[model samples]
Target: MNLSDRQSKLLFGGLVVGLTAVGVYLTVAAPDDEPERSKPRSVVTTGPTAPVAPPPGIATPVSPDSFDVYRLLPFSQQEFATAADLAQRFTAAYGTFRFDEEPRAYADRLAGMVTEQLGGELQRSAAAPGLQEERRAQQIVATGTATLDRVRDIENNSIIFLVTGKQQVTKAGKRSDDSKQYAVTVARDGGSLKVYAFEPADAGQEGDTG
Candidate 1:
């Protein structure tokens, strides 16, 4: 939470990038007579899914990958899926680490997966004494999983996903679980997806505490 001025600006910028894309997609892609939510909450959830009414433009329910909006976006269907997957993968890596590794060593796990700016912020956070001290004392070794809860935002070349990261921490033979929601932004890096920003949801990806 103690982010530097530069890191704060990076995260805030990512938060705003999606609104324009959302507006563009909604205006240009919809030919339906009625307007309905394009991406329902169930589009990505952690629990059982019930049948959802298809959006106004689509006559029938479609699988996530088969959604019609992908064709309307600057990015392709494959790229969207790949971006979502990268967001989840980044969340998992962010939560997983060993007690013995130095803080920088922990940050290295995220290399190549994040932008240079966000990567630096993560490294700095990982090195926070309060966060690392307890882990080292407890000899914690964490393994985690990330569930994409929903798409928070999108642009021509980026997607921000709301993800829940659950980590099982094993400390001195005892295991416990913890989870947190994050606004995870993945943007196009050359030809591949890379995480451009990550922050706890409470930080308000929308500028609150950015």
Candidate 2:
């Protein structure tokens, strides 16, 4: 071939080669350009939360030692001592007296003490006919023993105690005696202990016997 014809033929061959190279590069690089296969978007979800607990309530524990008797009676140490003293005085005052004596002074003292310790109920019970006969005929002696069985906190500044004891009566010349159980409910009134209730388990026992 002549020089011009040969040069043109060589240029055409070079162009074809370049076109093939570009096609191969595009096929290989197209897949790589596609957004990197996103590791399937992980969704981190948390579990359900736990429930919250409530606070506790106030607690009051009763004593088993004197629980039964204490429930029936409610008196404090000082009040019980005073009741016992008054009972002794009553015994001494009417120990050997005839039933006709009024027992006014003795009853007055008891009334006052009852008002202080047990309020009106005990005083009225003492004034009952049946109780009067027991006091006179049996020469009843009132003895008291005070015990702190248990202290229960009823409130921040208040407490209830389980208290229990005995009261007895005997005939003037007889050695045999009859006794009954008593209970006192005591509460803190301001700074001092007060008897909220005083109950005799056998107030009518004397009448029952006769």
Candidate 3:
């Protein structure tokens, strides 16, 4: 049987509405294209930093016991050793004069050594009449104590020492003594040690040079 024109038009309208509803439902149920929201990102930072280092050309400090003025001469150990040997020789010469019976001979020998080691000024000073009398009476004894006080590398090579004690003297069967503090400066002279200066600090006239 053939349908009427109005009924056929109504059927076509209903089919179009059903298709629209099915398209909407499929769009809502489809899976998403983007990744999962719970996953962590994979990013990297810059490379590790380098370590710090000390500067160059810095010198380490020296010990105090290693300081010696004579050692400073020529700035070498060999030169200082030579100066030390010479200092010992001078000590021997002065010691002989200090304990000799013939004071004049002792004075002559000491004057020669002083002139050679210290110069003409010291020689003249040793020859003074008053000084000669003191020598004859054995009023002084040239003695020293060598010690290494401190060694510092910050300031040019430097050393500190203390020479303290007394000199014994005998006059007319009576003995007397004197106490003095002496600081001796040392330097190297042509592979030998020479005393540059003797600074007297605390000097007290007690009695003798013994």
Candidate 2 structure quality by residue, lDDT tens digits, 1-210: 556988999989999999999999999998778786653677787998775444456254455765655334455445545544443333333223233445454455444323354555544544579867876776654433343444433433233334444333345655443333443344445545444544553444676955
Worst 10 residues of 2 by lDDT: 90-99
In model 3, the runs with Cα more than 4 Å from the true position are 1-119, 133-160, 202-210
What TM-score would each prediction reach against the true structure? 0.62, 0.36, 0.40
lDDT-better candidate, 1 vs 3: 1
lDDT of 3 by residue, 1-210 (tens): 787999999989999999999998788865453467656788887998775454566454445887566554434666444434444444445433343334455556655333355655555555677867866675444543232222222113322223443545455456666555444455534444455544453334356465
Candidate 3 Cα deviation (angstroms), residue 114: 5.9
Better of 1 and 2 by TM-score: 1
Of models 2 and 3, which has the larger TM-score? 3
Candidate 2 runs further than 4 Å off:
1-117, 156-158, 176-183, 188-192, 200-210
Q: Which candidate is the best by lDDT?
A: 1
Write the number of the candidate with greater TM-score, choosing between 1 and 3: 1
Q: Tell me which residue pairs clash in candidate 1.
A: none
The clash number for model 3 is 15
Q: In model 3, how large is the Cα lDDT of residue 125?
A: 57
Cα lDDT computed for each candidate against the true fold:
0.86, 0.49, 0.50
